[model samples]
Structure formats: structure tokens, C-alpha cells
Target: MIHEHEWQQWQQQSANHAATAAFLLLDVQTNLTMLETLQAALDKIRANPAAEPYSLSGNSYFIQLQPHRVLIEELYGDDYAEPVTLSLDDFGDALAYWHTQI
Candidate 1:
């Protein structure tokens, strides 16, 4: 469940990049659990490199999980845009940074 403190932390988090902005704007109910879900997807890919990629909608963005990496695409209502690639390790680092900031 989402906590007020967490939401407050998010409010103080940076949105300096497009990908970060997308993550920040995700719908709290269905998409705020992205870190866990993305980590799980990273594990799945690591377990089987041949595993098919999967795409999950984060209400306002789409995360496409591939082997060792993810593609983040911001969405506007029904429209989708180009995806930005991010290694799972890099995403972990980003999370770590956010944690430190909070």
C-alpha cells in the first residue's frame, strides 16, 4: 500500500528526465509498484535469456521488459511514443539514488 510519506518522498523526487517523469506520473493504484514489478521482470529475463519480452502499462507509460534491459515509453492518453532503453542495473542505481534522496 502507498503511504503518505512515500507520496511525499515522491513529490520531492527529481523529474529531470523524460523516463523519470514517466515513472513519477504513474497511476499510484496500479502502477506505483513498478520497482518490484520491474525487478521481477529482470529476474525472469536473467533466468531465461530466451524468454519473450513483456510490456506493462503504467497508466501513463509503458515498460517493455527485455533481456537485461527495459524500454520506457511515455504515453499521452491513447497515444504512445518512442521508448528509451535502460539497463536493469542502471535502473537499480537510479532507485538507489532516489532512496538516498528520500
Candidate 2:
């Protein structure tokens, strides 16, 4: 299991990435890279504006040698949250749902 400090580090790094819109070093999987995920998320944000009816949106960032994935919720009013989990499906669904609330 990953230590709590890792989560804190990830949170800080994520905040930095969100601000700079730059690629971040995340744990990678056999098929996915963290940088790739961040890029995809950036693309999604660009494509979907935070307007009424489409406020729910987020990005799934991965890490290497770890089972859990990070769910970054881009909520309305500039209030965002990152909840880490081991299930990709759950993160994806939750992000989709969150986007609708915005």
C-alpha cells in the first residue's frame, strides 16, 4: 500500500499540474502512462467548457507500481477534489456524474 505522504505529495503535484497545464510524472501501468492521462484530461477540459448542463468533468491520473488511480474532479465554481481509488471504472463513472452537477 502507498503511504499517506504519497497522497499528500500527489495532491500538491496535482495542484501544480492543474495550474501549469504541464505533464506530470505519475505511476504508470502496463498500457497507460500518467503523462498520457494528464494530456487526455487537458484535452477534455478544453473541449468541454464548464457551462451550465455540462459542469461535470474530471480526469483520471495513473501512477506506476501502484494499484490506485487518482480521480480529480473539476467541479463548478473552481472547487475541485481528488479522491484516489483502485478501481478505474468507479473513478470514470464518478467523474462523469460530477460533471453533470456543474
Candidate 3:
């Protein structure tokens, strides 16, 4: 589970980056607990090599990394009402940096 401090830091990073949404990409290799999966996901994101982006229903994006997946949603609402396609490179860079801060 994410500690209070970690959550606070994550919120700060999200605010700094102006991120609309964030999701954890759990590792599927091991039968890990929720806390462990969360931690592993965070670690992998920090060292993420590359990510593949897939469009999902309802203006959502799924970022896949092997056995893990990060879903970024609400990309085309309110703050971002216009249709905008964020580059994979940009997303990866932002995600990596955001994970590092957390």
C-alpha cells in the first residue's frame, strides 16, 4: 500500500506535471501482494525502457510494458476538451519522471 508520504509526494508530482490521471502498472511475473505489486510497478516505471500506447474506449489510453499496463484516462475532458494525441515518447518521459519523484 502507498504510505501517506508517498501519496502526498505523488500528488505533488502530478500537480507539478499537470497530469490528469495516473494508474499503477502491476507486475504479473510473481504472485505478489497488492503492496508489493504497487512497489514493483513503481520501480519498473522509474526504469521503464519503452512503452506501447493503445487507444481505449472513452478517450482513455493504455500504456503497456510487457506484463504490466498503465491506464491513463480522461485525456479529452474539461482541461483537455480538444482532441490531443500525446506522443509515446512524451508519455514515457513524463511517466518515468513522475515515478521517480514518487
Return the TM-score for each candidate structure: 0.57, 0.23, 0.29
- The local lDDT score (0 to 100) that residue 45 gets in candidate 2 is 41
lDDT of 1: 0.59
- Could you give candidate 1's per-residue lDDT for residues 29-86 as a string of tens digits? 3343555665577678878979999777766777777877877777665555566777
TM-score of 1: 0.57
lDDT of 3 by residue, 1-102 (tens): 334445545445543223322333322122235225444554565466353333333223233333233344443335653322333344445444445444
Taking the tens digit of each residue's C-alpha lDDT, what string does model 2 give over 1-102?
223444334335445334222112122222244334533554454455342221112243322211233333333345455533223333343233323322
Worst 10-residue lDDT window for candidate 3 reads: 20-29
List, in order, the clash count of every candidate structure: 0, 10, 0
TM-score leader: 1
Considering lDDT, where higher is better, how would the candidates rank from best to worst?
1, 3, 2
- Candidate 1: 10-residue stretch with minimal lDDT: 9-18
Residue pairs in candidate 2 whose N, alpha carbon or C atoms collide under 3 angstroms:
27-63, 27-64, 28-63, 28-64, 55-99, 55-102, 56-98, 56-99, 56-100, 57-99
